[model samples]
Target: MPVYVRGPKDIPDTVAQASAAASRVLQSIIKGKIIKSIKDMSLEKIETKAKE
Candidate 1:
C-alpha cells in the first residue's frame, strides 16, 4: 500500500492533523478489496496480479 505523510512543516494546525489522520483511516477501510479468508487486500495488489 502507498503511504502518505504530512511533512513536519506542512501541517501546522492541530485540527488539520486530526482531520487528516481520520481521513487516512477511513480511506484505508473503504479503499481495499474484501478477500474470502485472508485480510482485505488493496486494489493495487489485485491489479498487479491481473497483469501477471
Candidate 2:
C-alpha cells in the first residue's frame, strides 16, 4: 500500500536539476562502480554538498 502526500509538485530550476542529475548518473556509469544501497537514492548528501 502506498500513501500519497500532496504538496508542491513542481520542480524549481528544472533545467539545472536535470543537468545535475544527468551528470551524476553519467559519472556512476563511467566509473563502473555503481552499486545499490540507500545512499544511492539519497538526496541529502547532494543537498549538503550543494550548500557547501
How many clashes in each candidate?
Answer: 0, 0
Consecutive 10-residue window with the lowest summed lDDT within model 1: 32-41
The collision pairs in model 1 are: none
In candidate 2, which residue pairs clash? Answer: none
Instruction: Highest lDDT: give the candidate number.
Output: 2
Q: In angstroms, how far off is 8's CA in candidate 2? A: 7.1
lDDT of 1 by residue, 12-39 (tens): 5877889999988677668653344434
lDDT tens per residue, model 2, 1-52: 9677965446766777898999998987798545555466568865664464
- Top TM-score: which candidate number? 2
What's the lDDT of the predicted structure labeled candidate 2? Answer: 0.70
Candidate 1 residue spans exceeding 4 A from truth: 1-12, 33-52
Backbone clashes counted, model 1: 0
